[model samples]
Target: MKKILKACLLHSTAVSVSLLSFSFGVRAQTPQTPADEISPPVTDLLFGIERMMGSDSTLVETALEGFEEKYGDAVRGGDHIQGIAMTAGGQIVLSYSRQDPSKENCSGMLIYSSPFDPASPNRELDWDFYCETSNTDINNPPTGLGPEAHPSSLQASGNILAVGTHGGTRFYYLGPNGIEALHPNTAVLTGGRDSTGLTYNPVDRRFYLLNSDGSTAVGKNTIRLCRSDQDISLRQANQAIFTDSDCINIRDVYVSGQGANLIVQEDGTLFLVSTFSTRDLPDNLLGFADDNTDAIWGAYGTRCALETALLPGYGFRASFEDHIYISELDFSNRTADLVMKRDIRRTQAVQTCVDKRPAFRFAGGVATIRNGALLGLWSGRQNPPLLSLNDSYEFAFQDLPQPIKSASVSEEKAYLFRENNTYYRYTDSQGVDPGYPASTSRNWDFDVEGDDKEILGAVRYDNGHVYLFLEDGYYSRLEKDGSTSPGYPVKITDNNWPGLAPYAERIRAVINWGNGNIYFFLENRGPFGGTLLGDGEYVRYNIAKNRIDLGPRSIEGPWGILGDYDTDITAAVNWWNGKAYFFLEGGEYIRWDIDTDETAGPIRTSKYWPGVSDDEDITAAFRHQR
Candidate 1:
């Protein structure tokens, strides 16, 4: 029912989010693995030759042969390898699922030993699949139960693992001890179905979730959060939920400057940048006049800002902190906070540099990691935008041999991770994308991964590597130094992973909890199910142990994912002080204490703003600095 539909919209006399043309690729299907069959390793590799260089292919081939020799029998016997995670200690956990009839949304989990040492006591530990046996009815399933039990994302703080399951449920796995349900078994709070994206930032100790779905009568989306130490299940019946609805449909979410600021990309209109705190996630909405005199065009991928140095003459500087810089298709624009500060001619050079990318392809998104440094990616025909700011900022677009679908910005370099395609890394002292370079030690190809495609969700950059999750059901890791292994693609199904794949259609959501855990969402399309893997599946990739833990089945049907199909879930997680936070697609959000691994109370948000209708959508989330 949910077509590859981009919302069709038109703005009023003022500016609005335009439905820019999206380059659509055919969704080709690979040979399906029967319930008892295992997918060929070679079948999982190869999309572009760029990824098959020298030892990379050999590494993957060797790993595949080893897996087949020792584990191939078990895989063929039936094991659903879903998602992965890497821990701070370097333990990698691989999750697998198996089907069961005890519950409608049944699933399971298997913990792999540490990748650092398989002989270590932490080898693959097969645990009983945690099914959705909670006694809750669908029409009135308990708070966190229902067909939407697909565990969307997982976060670990201290020794506790906080599982943000489908249908707005928070399942807490207290490490060696056991599991505890954090939220109440009621539908009043978690907007019925599974909300989309969820993330937890370690530094901030708060969780963030984006709210989608048509529950609220008013249009526009809502963003919510929960603290790390409080018990989400003990909240009152009608407590005032903490949320910021000032922005419309939030498409993508990002937290950077180490929680000093938050950014949300709403459709193709505004890149809302704001500051986050324990109290509120407010965004300063600068009112635009009816006249077109002071209006700026909404660039789909870039953000716009005015130079702070030029704001003193205008009263706008008081309302604004530093000058804001937003990106445009042809050029970048800067507006002062106050009308008096509007000396556009003085800051014209800055604007010119912003638009000077060597390539003119559609700049899809921009991310700032350490400080003012940023990396920009293009959608398809567009070019990558690179900008480095010192005393005088510089902007340039480089032409890559291949088009980059999505990218993540890191401290010293920019990682261009693609889906169904090869991967590349570009380095510029100026922090700009160096159009596909001819020769740079910084080049590694991931095209060897099965049917390389532009990755849908945002790529995640953490520690020293970039994790590329493509739509072809494969996830690969590439080091910033330009080292990549052939796609060690893993498969997911009910037989292998019981709990998380009930609705197995949509498995694109991913978030990296800085401590080494990788959280992801999967779709569960009820008994009848949707497109084979269309239902959401919640997955985790343990980088430390090289194993997976898959379960916490969804009881409700599909409709539980957050972010646009291609939006990165990592952007939603915010780390502040000693906590981590994230928001779901349906407006339900939670937080975790990095120090305690405890969940604070759940935070609910109103579905619609005053002027918005239930039919509208959430485009993005950003912070309005205090």
Candidate 2:
């Protein structure tokens, strides 16, 4: 492995100067000792590198004194600073955010330490120093925490501090030492309650901002993202609002210049899920360059959930036409593969399930497309568990909306599903009502039926067929037409399903890769037969060979799961690129790869939308199909 050096220097002095004079292009002076020759402690070596990279001699000397004052002999031993990250270049940087009052000011400080060598083997110098700052505010603002500066994310790129704060999103162009706001103040994303999940797409050279669920001048709980990296004011920020429907909470957005998609998952009973985009339109509403606005134009979002889903080349697909997919807890199994296109010729196109028992269905999380596919998660569904999908409307293309409680997608035609338990696939089983008033076009119904009504999981058409996986381990195939193929659901054994662990109660979720495979999660019970029997376990199912590979269980015995298993599974899984990403209750985010057979993380966090944790009722994420 090639060794990289990064150093931090804390200066105990006040230094505010011009940016050009203190930029990153400082000359590397020939010290008495060569940096390549020193074997000093990593800390000292890193500190030395900072000094050498820096051009300010006064700042360097001051930092050295501070280092000596802080760590006497330890400075030579190099044992501090827990985390480290490097830019594509060799520039070393460190990040720490503190809302606590004890550090400098309430405004959190981000620091960068240059090359500071403790012993210069080439120059005969014993130690080199780097500079640090007390107040690292943007535009040299005051000591208080403001909206623009309460950074949710802080990254250093070139001479810029890429900042995405709760207030608005903007960048601060800083030299090696000083701060400069890059764009006009009015062009920033400073109006929102929170701005997070920011990405600086090098391909497009634009900064993407995912806004939190809050009120804007137009409505409440909307999703907005900006493409301009230099805009400092919210007004100038070219933003696309994903979900404009009333009370839609858009969570965690991702964008790539190749395509634009928004996933909106609401958080209440009948939670509205939808996806919107401008890619498929014939011409721009406000005409500009057709493909420019078609491909690279400014802000716009739509409300057609079905059109977003059926627009075939959507996810994991190479071609792109905007699409949507939705996952809802089916109290009555009648809501399977049901789609009601909004048209005057079709009445009874929309199918509604009247639950005999009390039920709660909602959306929890969603992801927009950037490079590969768009995905959304629907939770709090029963039987089939959670769901994942490439587009929200894929399941609803026909009259019987796929009974996916929850789902997420990795790419076009590839998907994951929860709460599926059927062995038959239905396609074009019913047609739109030819004789209907324009007022009742959405009231159409499809003619399809099977004992396999519950859909535990599904993968989009990789081999020209939408592969459906059920909870009971049944597999069905669906084609473009509304027809059904009574295929056998691939069953997983106790060794494969693993939920049969001595104390395990049931399997929790499943994801379908575009290829012929399925990944399943099992939640077990406690060792002593506690209220909750076991923790969650994972498994993969091979459709071609018909085999299941189970894995070790989780720490939280899976029996007494977080929410009610009677109606909702409370989790979702998605496959992206070649990896499977799973989101579950108790706020867990996990990923696994089939080819690599490696799992990434089980990171746990709460819901991105507010009011989700308050009621303890389950919340799901699903994209709305227009």
Candidate 3:
């Protein structure tokens, strides 16, 4: 058995039932016919149970009376909705598990026409034509062999409808013309014991199925990929195979004997969620929520039924038992956080049974509509309701403890090195506090030092590592977490090459071009300091070879313009467009072309870039593309 980790929301609160109650109105009526003999209503009225009929006879009767009054005409005696799918055109396709099996026309699937206005009391459904079986001559009837066949899951893409049957190995596709068997008996990818979930990826033009034995054990569940050149015939061609070893453990969560569901976003990111775990397949293992009780006789025997929906902006919403959780997924970190959670039971007296335990069985499926509203289906004696939630977790940037000395940015996050050798990371949306502190080990002891170890510059390379240049002619390579790389603080002295020894202590500035080259500015501050020694030299540090090239002698030619400034080279930054700009002491700057090894200007910074003040001195500058 795999260990189950509880990943509940950081702050759990009660959802307001009053808002849902106002949307769903109850009706009064006593069913005169048997459940299986009744026909589905064609009106726009909201149907289905809102609350469960607990052991309390008085409460159950009162709830039943309200349902009878509002939806008595739409309620079928034994009609139990199993699955639902909504199309882009606003059409709703519903599957019933306990439809009248005797009716030759009872296909267990119904199609509700569009313009399903929740405010309208007289909405209409196409009750004459079912999804699986239609009386019309143009559409074909369901291809299943038995009348007992019931749909377990339903999914829609454009006008195509994909239906999975309970306890059946094959899935069915319903189109404008008719219904057909999606998988043949000889197909390579026969669904598991029961096909619980089905989804279509428009990008790849393929269908994905979640087949499992209902065990939350590793390797007991499988995700089958179905593909076909034609729209009608689907064949199992492959399984969701992961290249990552950590993702291999994801199959364990599906082993739990509960129905599982899948959702594929427009970006081809696949999400699989079961009662045991929610996984962003191929890598991330989003932990599970614990709502199970020790009592077997409780409203929900063990665990809560689980379902997930992909909201806009990459937000993931999960409905586990009686609580709804909203989480933001960080694909870079391979982790997700439960940002907000709402427990529906807190606001409803009808949520618990006579035993006072929450009855999760009364809850139904959750679907996200085009307008971003969540429609929930419930069963028992009350009417289902619509819930609208603001599930977005906006990132808030926190103030840094100290001013940033130098900063570098990666694809997913920004790194800020503070004046105290402490570093923090800023995501595209928010800033993080200080992480691992910078390393203290030095390659050589400083001769003139009084605890003021200034960080001269910092840069993030193309290879994802960061380098921090110190004032003492030494540098340290830092890991993404800000910790010093092993054997760091390498001295700038050319001990291995003998060429860099002369300018070792005279190194004044450094800048990483993001490519494989790190450019160093060496100034000859005569023995007494402040005395200019000709034009300072500029050298290119070969990052891969870990050696400085002395053959070029120095940056002569167009680069020799920097030699005029001598020690006045104040700051340098690799701009977003890939060019390096060197700022001089008098607010004058020059653009260096990394590719051609040329200089563009001795232009005044105040004239070209007004944001940079001439009198204002900058310690360091770096590129940050958030």
Q: Tell me the tens digit of each residue's lDDT in model 3 across 1-626.
A: 00111111121121111100112234365312221111111111111111211121111111111222322233343333444544433444545443443444434543333323221212232321243332211122234322123444444443444444433333333433333333334122234433344444444544444444443222244433333332222322122221122121122233222223444444544444332222211111233233222222222312222111111111222222233333222233444343433333311222222112212232123333332222332222122211111111110000111111133235455333333333334342433422222212111111123233555565666665666666666666765544456776666566742465555555556677767777767664444566545555577777788777643234445366776665677556676455777877666778887677688777876565523345444434454532
lDDT of each: 0.28, 0.29, 0.37
**What lDDT, from 0 to 1, does candidate 3 have?**
0.37
Error of 1 at 216 (Å): 21
Task: For model 2, state the Cα shift of residue 181 in Å.
Answer: 12
Give the alpha carbon lDDT tens digit for every residue of 1-626 in model 2: 00111223334333343222222343475212222111111111111111110011111111222433432221111111211112222122322222322334323333333431211101111122222222334343322222222233333333343444444444443334434343333224433432233333333333333444321111223345434432222222223322222112333322211111111222211111232222332235555675564232222323122333444221222111222222221212312121211111110112111010001111111221111111221111111111211100101011111212122111222121222111111111221111111110011111123233334444443353454434444444554432344443344445543443332224455556546665555545457755365444555566665555544444234322322231233444343456545455554554556567565444542332221221121222211111
Model 1: per-residue Cα lDDT over 450-480, one tens digit each:
2333343333444545554445454455554
Superposed model 3: Cα runs more than 4 Å off? 1-79, 99-148, 166-189, 193-195, 202-205, 214-250, 254-259, 274-363, 366-626
Deviation (Å) of 506 in candidate 2: 19
Query: Which model scores highest in TM-score?
Result: 3
Model 1 TM: 0.24
